[model samples]
Target: MSQPQAAVGAAVPRVDARLRVTGRAKYAADNSPDGVVHAVIVDSSVGRGRVTGIDTRAAEGQTGVLKVISHLNAPELPPVEGGFPPGEPLRPFQDDRVRFFGQPVAVVLATTLEVAQHAASLVEVAYDAEPVSTDISVADPADEPETYARGDADGALDSAPVRLDLTYRMARNHHNPIEPAGIVARWDGDRLTVWEKTQDVQGTVATLSGEFGIPPDRVRVISPFVGGGFGSAARAWVHSVIAALAAREVKRPVKLVLTRRQLYFGVGYRPAYEYDLRLGASRQGRLTASAHDIRTENSRYERHSEGVLQPGRMLYSTPNVRQAYRHVPLDVSTPWFMRGPGYSTASYAIESAMDELAHELSLDPLKLRLRNEPADDESSGRPFSTRRLRECYLAGAREFGWHRRNPKPRSTRDGDWLIGMGMAAGVYDTERSEAHASVRLDADGTALVQSSASDMGPGTATSMTQVASDALGLTMRQVTFRLGDSLMPPAPGHHGSRTMASVGSAVQDGCDKLREQAISLAVRDEDSPLYGADAADIVVRGGRLYVKDEPTRGETYQRLLARNNRSHLEAIGSYAGASESEKFSFYAYAATFAEVAVDARLGLVRVRRMVGVYDAARIINPRLADSQAIGAMTGGIGQALLEHTVTDHRDGRIVNANLADYLVPTHADMPDMKAIYIEGEDYEADPIGVKGLGEIVIVGVAPAIANAVFNATGRRIRELPITPEALL
Candidate 1:
């Protein structure tokens, strides 16, 4: 028997790589609409104030200047609506109130970008300044802390034999993709077309339509390529709206691209966090209770928060657990979801506490986690769809040589540097939102599939093509998958690692239906070679429909379609979402191990190598999956040792707004990194059996490095970025 030709699990290259490398793939800023003019924004100088008056006389006098738009002259827009819940949206130029520093107060339109930029700088504004508080520590809580409790946490903590209380702080981080946030908006009569850099094309359409009071069908968003998002490009910001408004007023296309400095305020960033964790465990390393008090910073207007406490509630088996998440509204711009969101931040505190407990109990860190592994989700009391965290630990430990490590801090030395190894477990919820895909099989034996999903560096198009190619029994070259257009089938934005499980399933569903249509045609036709074959027994392979038991009785798709007079067969595939059966907990798990060399005298920490083993169910394109894991691990390294967004608390200004000051991992910083995936599939999680991989890879990375630093040096640092000053 011949096995089916499979592309789903193959290590296929990205379909769009050629276009990207050749600079042919059009980004948002690359598009040049007819009669396109340039637009540049003027930001407010004061952090918190109300604009008294605006003087645009100098800007208007500049040659090639089209218009200077500000609160004094810009038209009123409909009230902004629809975003992640809990906060009022910020509307552009709606009034004179300046909520934060660098708030967009005006825009300049001109014939060229330089002219617009020069004109924007000339616009002067007057403001009535007010006292501003950007410091997270000084800001009062915006609302009552949200609390969750399961058992008697205080009582359990008091009775526990071993206890540890630790406080950890993480600095704010920004998403600085090489391509800055940009938009090219064009208006034709009442219809609007925008080429935007966004993670969600449909979300942009809905947001723009609501803001403009236009019907949804009249707004079109095209974003086939996104340089990088890391969650910053997930929403439609005020710049996109400003571009559209300017285009409508000027009766021409308007292009606006945020500079590197402007990106700090133009888009949202990951909020800084102060996490206080109190843990209780038995003498034998059994977890008894856990309490987490988390305070995160956000804008004064919007209350932004992510899934921060989920790791505390579900990552381990604790009978008594309590959590309180408080949003401290500061005089700053709104914060948004970043890579790993809440789980990454929480993992640092929870996982570090676990490491401390291991040191206190004299048990191996991995063994301690293994001992407390729950049979089901302790929070929900539901069985897991597929939990292979134990497998990840075993594999990662074996690959990283964890058994050779000395648990005693500062014990192992390599001449001037102290050597240490540490490991931490990671978890991300399996999120599957509703998505739809359209697949069409042409009579010429080629197939096309499309979704409205965005590819923010995770190879969404490549992965979906692999799925469709396998499902439709077509070769890799015969299938092409397209995404990032609002006119295509609707898809949830690519975030929380949900694109593969949601959009991939829809592609599979749509391709399966199309294949069935061809099978029906081949079986029913009397002139076809497959006429006598049963439809159920017929299988399609290499564009040929043949009986499974008898391969010789077959006919080609082109021949079959020609005889049937069919030009093409199309179907719309849809995945409603995960079932509501309430029987299973679905999550992607990883075990991250790091080896670091710390110069105790000089306060220098260098990560020598790192290993990440993931049980992210059903590998689709192993090459792409590996790239995703490695990229995430690199970001994790940055979070642990390099990246920090320094803000000037006095004036609510980001001091390191540019890449030169705001550090990220360069080639010299990346160590010998390895990514490994345990081979398996979780069919219960979704149709394609893919547990998401993007977010899980970054979850435990920071803690692993932090724990390794502790192992290398006798001192333990709870704060993030593990600065040299702290080591000294």
Candidate 2:
């Protein structure tokens, strides 16, 4: 009989889809321990101040209010060992100083969530306010910038035949996931267990252990499901610490969930950016030199930085390049990664500048990008492992019907709507980290795999199951994948799109080892049908081992294991990660196209359709890949037209903290979207040959829409969101 089809390349439905749709999957806040109590935090009103007094008498008098804890009565936490970025992480109730407007000052515990919320409001606080610097435009950047220079950018810009100078501003964005940040902490003696909504369970365990000064093994983090993270849940925020601390103090399980408004200040956000770009190119669209000066916001106490300067340095073949990235301190919470992160932000400026150059030179936007494609990574001076960007562009152009577009601005029009088409290129680094997985093949001919990696809605379990099934020569139904428990084999946090390349490789290794062990036992057994067969010549399909040349001589794994009297075969698989001395520059590439309709009179812009073609090596599951690309495109729509976190600088307050005021893309706003992936693999990049698909999908989306808007209305709106006021 012919061998069964492999499960790796098939479009399999998510393994947990049934559980998710039926409300059987337990989220972080879904768990309520036997004696769980509720805790609510009281936020500071002043932007910058010292707590003069905190009156908890009224809160203490309320019925069901167990205690109101603040700096005065709260126990001191041990010094944390290591924190994110490079500064002091916010410690809940550690001192009287209020660094930001919504800094948590006190927590109230009660028998019910309603009582805790009511009592938290009754707790009074007085502060000595100080003048705060909350504005990024007016604030001074760091005196010494992080700078990179290869050739004389200034001299080259002066001598180039064509040049363009542009400045763009982007609004700060929040990760408003459907599930708010929450934690349920229960301590028994010196050991602790927490059910948290987080992207990294092991990262949470480490943070909690460091704060409580306990061994790492003493803290257990269980997170089976995460509604959505988008980088907000990557780290253990201050709310998590507060919940654990309260549970320890009260000697009972404590559950703390941030309100929708509190999410604005409680968790991390994408920092706003002010980017000034200067480009010098030949008249024929050959890039010669570029200079980028970027300024972004961070907290006064801690500094947060990202890869905003990377794309500026190496996206195209520029001989001379200069970059200076600086952080402006503000009296606000420190920013963190959101979706595409720095690469997406930089692409907005670089890709927009390229489009502007194309308009100036009277060339097709796609052709202009093709003219400047780099042979190798200029920044690192290394050849790319697999750069299919040219293929991506060609595929996108054909699928998007680039030839039908009218190059002239304001040239295509329907009834009261000016139609325009535009496109941009995007790039993101292919990052990998060390990971491990545990695999076991039971005597009953089934397999179980476990890892500590998280699945923040990317269908990680499904993808891993596919890999394991293919490697073990078993049907998809015979393999099961489990994740999100700290006790499992170690793996990196589920961010940066590294889960598939790193964790998937580990699973493949474990399954392959276990299969080889079974083959060895079968080849050596006297009673087995393939007893004398060469192990190297043996292949397995549907749990049956047979010789490659002679298919009839085979034995079922069930019979082979029973003859050996073995209960199970197990192995620990590991991936040492990317090479320290890397030979090639690795990155994922995308070409995004957009068609938009602009109403000049009403200053409104609506996207009609979008097409994105990507070079994310070797898709494991087409269904999951399409979901990631489409979801990211939707986020791109929000970034381009709706999402913005408004702040009132006068008091450092987020003016539009709730969803009603802060806008996002509803189902009504989404238009036709299509995502296409180039087929093939890049073995040089990783063992699994996947370059990561999540972040690159959103990288160039905003610029494509912006370019389309310009084409429709002949207006160069440098700022984001393409608001009506700007168009008018």
Candidate 2 accuracy as lDDT: 0.92
Model 2, runs deviating above 4 Å: 1-5
Instruction: Find the 10 residues in a row with the least total lDDT in model 2.
Output: 1-10
TM-score to true structure, per model: 0.99, 0.99
Backbone clashes under 3 angstroms, per model: 0, 0
Clashes of 1: 0
TM-score, structure 1 vs. true = 0.99
Best by lDDT: 2
What is the C-alpha lDDT profile of model 2 across 1-728, one tens digit per residue? Answer: 22334998799999999999999999999999999999999999989989999999999999999989899999999887457777899998989999998999999999999999999999999999998888999999878789999899999999999999999999999999999999999999999999999898888998999988999999999998999989999999999999999999999999999999999998889999999999999999999999999999999888888889999888899999999999999999889999989999999999999999999999998889999999999999999999999999999999999999998999999888999898999999898989999999888999899999998899999999999988888998999999999999989999998999999989988887888888899888999998878888888889888898888999888898888898889999999889999999999999999999988589788889999999999999999999999899899988988888888888899999999988988888888999999998988978878988999999999999999998998888999877888888
lDDT of 1 by residue, 449-544 (tens): 999999999999899988888788888899989899999999998898999999999998998888888888877788998886777888888888
- For candidate 2, give the lDDT of residue 657: 96
What local lDDT does model 1 show for residue 185? 96
Candidate 2 lDDT score at position 605: 83
